[model samples]
Target chain A: MSAIEVSGLRKAYGGVTAVDGVDLDVAAGEVFALLGPNGAGKSTTVEVLEGHRKRDSGEVRVLGRDPGKPSGDWRARIGVVLQATSDAAELTVREAVAHFAGYYPNPRDADAVIDLVGLTEKAGARAGKLSGGQRRRLDVALGIVGRPELLFLDEPTTGFDPEARRQFWRLIRLLADEGTTILLTTHYLDEAEALADRVAVIARGRIVAEGTPSTLGGRATAEATVRWRGADGPQVRRTPDPQRLIVELARHEELAELTVSRPTLEDVYLDLIGERA
Target chain B: MSTMAVGAARGRLELREFFRRKDAVVFTFALPAFLLVLLGSVFSGTVLGDMSMSQLFTASMVGAGIISTSFITLGVGVAGDREDGTLKRLRGTPMPVAAYFLGKLALVAVASVAEVALLLAVGIGLYGVELPADPARWLTFAWVFGLGVVSCALLGIAASAAAKSARSAPAVMNLPYIGLQFISGVFINPIVVLPSAMVAVASFFPLKWIAQGMRSVFLPDEAAVLEMAGTWEHGMTALVLGAWCVVGLGLCLVTFRWTDE
Candidate 1:
């Protein structure tokens, strides 16, 4: 069964529509990413699913329960890592994690969750004293301490350094491997490609495209560009069948500095969002 | 775990967080005692034949101190929690809403007790203000303290929803508090000294009744002659404070929001 199912989900703040008739389905144990620009309804949609928001109209079944009428048991089954949280500054990481564990019927060990987030060394330190990346890890530690079956990560690595981002990706992969279904929202195309099994591009409160990263917006079947150093000068050609063009050129003449490239996830993502590269 | 169990755990964490912040501890606990000392020293004269001005201020200030710990501390704390994403994170978890409120009640109860103790110590040690020797007066103190803390704490939580952010919470909470202290006779001795209109206005608020209840406990029966109605009016005190408890709870139910949205 799908972990999440939404159809015709519509929400508006005052006269401004934040999410307009968006539909989504996330199967159990799958990593789904919603990619969008700022104010593109990514967070709004995720908040609705997390039961932190009330939708104007739609049907949403998260883990087979309506999120709008959330219960403690329903909340216990899902974990959420919100964007830009700076709470729990006074408590040490260990205390904060342990305190949250008591809220759920089944919880992961506090120490183990701390180690999983690579914050074991700083477990005794106050959350307020941690750097930005370390604080984010603490947020993640609190998020997963309950051993939730489904996790929602909203732009989890927004301000991380490259190394920190890579470590966070590995942790996400580890969780995904452990059979935890995850719903992620991000502006980073590389992050979506690295972590999401399937990605959906949201633009102006609607899903513009949805598929596996390689095939999203037809990236897998899109035309390729071939380039080489010709006798006249540099040469470039765009073609759906790049192999045939490469063979034709190789048989007729010597191709110097030859290269062939297809669209990257970022390229397709940018095109889907109507942004120029 | 049961919701009450989780609430108890939350209470422990809330206490840890509250004591860890040195500024909050000092400001919330020490400010009232400090003000009492400064004011009591300045006004050493007697209001009645045996009742000194410092003694009158001491009794009234105790009531103010309780409000400080409950109303101001809670207003600022709740607003800070909202601004810093603490409420949002708690809402996202399996923690029940009742559990969160129970935690706040625990924090306010503990802190107000400590604050009252500090003010009483300062009142007795420095100002020569006497504690009630009669068991009946002690009973009055008990009920007054209980009702005052509940009513003020509820109003504090309700006021937090009106504050735009934590940065503005102190101003939002303190304006009414300081204003009430003056008109309620905490700063001025002899409840009759204030303008009759101002006294009437203060009579409508919990602070005036709370101070009157405290005075009834600490002051001699003869001092009742100086009260607004020329009596302790114990029945009136209970009625006003009890009514405030209901009104404050109604306001809290109407105004409270987990987030600004």
Candidate 2:
């Protein structure tokens, strides 16, 4: 069975509709990324799936059961790492992890989970004293200490430096290797490319596109830009067949500083969201 | 683990966090005792025959201490939890809602006991307030303390939902709490001293009954004449406190929210 299945999901706050008639499916053990700008309903959609918010109307199943009626046993199967949480600031990293572990019937070792998040050196330190990245790591540690089969990570790496972001991606890869299904929501396109097997772009309360990271919004098959220094000046051409165009250009004259490039994930993402003119 | 066991664990963690906060320890645990000392010393004269104002303030302060720990402390603490993402994080976990409340209750129970002990010590050692000699008075103290803490705690949880954020919680909780102290005769002694209108207002709340019950335990039986009715109204106290418990529980059920959303 799929890890998550939703169709015709709708939710609104009074007059403003946050998520409108959304549909989504995430297969078991697959890493799915939902990409959207702020206020585009990514967090709202994830909150509904996490059973934290009630949907206005929807048919949704997570782990083959409706998340709307959550039970302790059902909750045990899913882990949720929320956005920008500063909870448990008074507890040490080890204490917080151990405390959350008790909630699950089958929990990962607290120390092991802490180590997985690379917080071993700060295990004895209070959560309030940690830097921003370290605090986020502790949040992840608490989320996975239960050894959930399905994990929901909402913008998990929002404020990380470059090195910390790389480390977080590695930790996520390790979890995915263990066959844990992960539904991640992030606006960073490169993060989606680095970790997710499939990606969905949501804009204004609706998903505009969904596909693999390489093929999202037809990224792989879209026309490539070919650029070269010609006799006149620097020349650029858009072509569906870049190799053929490059060969034809070479037959006439030596192409100086020649390059053929496909659209980046960011470029396609911006285009899909109608942010690029 | 059973839900109760998990609740106990949550309680242990809650206590650990509560004590680690230096400001919370000083303010919540020690402020009431300090107030008892300050107020008990300021008032020198006796209201009734041989019952010094210090003794009356000391006995009544015990009930106020219980309410401070259970109501103000919990109202602010729960609002802080909501603001700081504690509630949202717990909602994501497998922790049962009952267990979460059990943990808060446990914190209140321990804190209230310690608060009462500190207040009593101050009352006995510093002020010349005497402990009750009869076992029956201790029984009254026990039931009054328990019912007062529970009703106040439930009301505090319900009140927390009204606070916009943790920063505003103190103002939201303290306005009514400090006001009630005067009308309820915790800050003011001899219930007859307050206006009849204010006494009627205090009668609707658990604080007045709790203070009157504590007075019944600590003061001499003849001192009941100082009360508004000129007698210790134990049956009325029990009925009022019991009714507040039901009302407080209903408010909690209706108003409590895990998140502001």
Candidate 3:
């Protein structure tokens, strides 16, 4: 069974439509990324799936139960890592994790989850006293201590440094390896590319594109740019086949600083979102 | 885990949270003890009608402690947590909201115990206030203390629900907190000193009842003549406090939002 399914989902806050006629599906054990710019309804959509927000209209199922009216058991099966660090500032890292662990039916060991988040050394430190990156790791520790079947990470790496970002990616990969389905929302393109099995881009409350990262918006099949220094000082050409162009150029016996390039996933993503405007 | 276990775990963690903060521990638990000392020493040989000044001051301060600590502290604490996203994180869990409240309530109860104990010990040690002679009066103290905590804590929850931001939390809590203090005789004995309007207003809240009820328990029975009604009015005290608990809790449950509106 799919980990999640949504059809014709709609939500509005006052008169402003946040999520409009959206549909989505995630197969079991799949790692899906929801990518969008600010105010693109990414959070509103995710909140609905987590049963934190009510939808105006939709057929939504998470683990075969309606998220609109989630039972306690349904909540137990899902974990959520919010955009901000949890407000457990006064407690030690171990205490915060242990406290949340008690909320689930079969919780993961608190110490183990702490070690998994690379926070073992800071386990005794107050959660509020931790650095920004360290506190985010604590958030992940609390998120996973419940041993949830599905985890939702909303902008999970927003405040992380480059090193911290890489470390967090490893933790996410570890969770996925343990067969925990993941639905992540992020603004960083590289983050989505590195961890997402599939990604969807949303703009102004509507999805603009959805596919594998490598081929999203036909990025893989898109025209490539071939460039080299020639008699004209420089030359550039666009073609669907860079290999053939390179082969033809190679016959000249020399090509100065020759290079072939394709539009990156980011490039294609921007164009897709721009197309709507 | 069972719901009770979750509540206990959260409660334990919250207790640590309560003590770890120098400000929360000092302001919520230590302030009343400090007030008892300062006031008791100043009015060393004075008397308010039939009661010694120390006895009256100690009784009134107990009501003030319940309001300042349980009502003001928890009011700001709850508002700050909601503003900063702590409560929202708990909302995502299977842990019932009631369990979170149980943790908060437990913390308030413990703080109230510490506050009362400190004030009583200091009043008896420094001044010459006497403990209740009758064992049954202790029972009245217990129930009145319990009910006072409930009434004040619920008021805290309701205030937090109304607070729009952490910055506004203090004003949200202190408005009613300070208002109730003056009318309820926390800073001074209001038995004969309170204007009729103040008496009428304070009658609706639990703080005045708490002070009067505690005075009946801690002071000699003959001291009851100093009260406006010349009696302990135990029934009215229970009724008013119980009603506040019911109404305050109802208001909180109905209006409390896990996320900022």
Candidate 4:
């Protein structure tokens, strides 16, 4: 069975519709990324799937049961790292992670989870004293300590430094390697490209496109842009056959600074976000 | 973890957090002790019926202490936690939301007990406060203290719904509490001597009942003449507090919010 299946999900607030209509399916053990700009209803959609918000109408089956009527056993199998900062400010990192671990049936060792998040050195420090990036790491630790079969990370690396972000990416890869299904929402296109096996770009409360990161928006095999310095000075051409164009250029003249480029994931994402905005 | 185990862990966390802030600890325990000593010393020369003012005021502080330590403390603490997203975080966990409140209650209960102990030690050691020789008086103190703590804890949970943020929690809890103290005669002498309208209004809340119950324990029978209708109204105290308990629990069930929404 799919890890998550949502059909025509709809939610609104008074006069404003947040999630107008949405459908998603994540296969078991797949790493899925939800990409969207601010106000695209990504948070609202995730909250509904997490059983933290009530949807107006739709069918959502997560781990073979409706999240709307979540039980303790069901919650034990899923872990959530929210956008909001963890507020166990008085607790040390180890204490905070240990406390959350007790909520699950089979939890990972708190110390190991702390080390996984690269917080072993600061494990004894109070949560309130940690820097923003360190606190984000601690949040991830608490979320994964439950040994969840499926983990939900909602904009998990908002405040991370470059090194911390790379470390976090590695940790997520390790979890996914162990066959843990992960559903992540992030704004960074590179982060999505580096981790997501499948990516969905949402705009204005709806999914604009969904596919593998490399092929999203037909970028994988789309017409390439060929550029080179020529006798005329400089030249640019868009063609489906970039290799033939390069060969033609070489026969005509010695190519200088020749290059072929394809549109990046960020280029497609911006177009998607802008088209709906 | 089992529900009981979760409650224990949360309770320990709550107590540790409560003490880590020196101001909350001072306000929770020291405020009552300070007030008890101040009132006992100020009224040492006065007597209500056969009971010295020090002894009589000691009983009133015990009632006030229960409300302050348990009811007000929970109201403010729950409101603060709700405002700061702490409760929202816990709601997502497998730990039952009810267990969070259970832990809060446990914290308040322990604080209330310690608060009473502090007040009693101050009263007996310093003021030489009167203590009834009858074992029944201690029994009355025990049950009354229990009922008072529970009823206030419930009401406090309900009252937290009105607090919009952490900054407003103290105001939310204190406004009604200060008013109740006056109406319940915590600051007044000759409680029965108050106008009938005031006494009637005070009867609607648990503070007056708690005060009356505590008074029944510390005072000799002759002092009953100084109370409303020239009697201790022991049965009425239980019935009234019991009714408040039911109403407080109802309000809590209806108004408790895991998030600030």
Mind giving the per-residue lDDT tens digits that candidate 1 earns over B1-261? 887887888888988999898767887778889999998999988876867888888899989999998999889989999989999999889999999988888988888888888888988998787777899999999999999999999999999998999999989999999999999989888889889999999999999999999999998999998799999999999999999999999999999988877
TM-score of 4: 0.92
Q: Of all true interface contacts, what fraction is found in model 3?
A: 0.86
- Give the poorly placed runs of model 1, Cα more than 4 Å off: A251-257
lDDT of 3 by residue, A1-277 (tens): 8999988889999999998888889988989999888888999999999999999998999989999897888888999999885587888899888878888889999999999999999999988899988998898888888889999999988878999999999999999999999999998999999999999998888888899999898888989999999866889999999899889888875789888888988788788778434
What are the runs in model 3 whose C-alpha is more than 4 Å off?
Answer: A275-277, B48-51
Model 1: lDDT of residue A143:
86
Residues A1-277 of candidate 4: C-alpha lDDT, one tens digit per residue: 6999998899998989989889999999999999999999999999899999999999999999899998988888888887856488888998888888887789999999999888999999999899888888887787788888899999988867888889889989999999999999999998999999999998888998999999999998989999889888888999999999898778869889889999889888998888534
TM-score of 2: 0.97
Model 1 local distance difference test score: 0.92
Model 4 stretches with alpha carbons more than 4 Å out: A226-236, A250-259, A275-277, B48-51, B130-133, B190-195
Over B1-261, each residue of candidate 3 has an lDDT whose tens digit, in order, gives 666777777777778888888878886678788878887777756554555687888878876787676888789889888988888898888998778888888888877887888888887887777787788999999889888889889889888988889889888777887687777777666466788788888888888899888887888777787777889999999999999999988989898878786
Interface RMSD of each: 0.7, 0.6, 1.3, 1.4
A120 Cα displacement, candidate 3 (Å):
0.9
Residue A93 lDDT in model 1?
97
Per-candidate Cα lDDT values, in order, are 0.92, 0.92, 0.86, 0.86
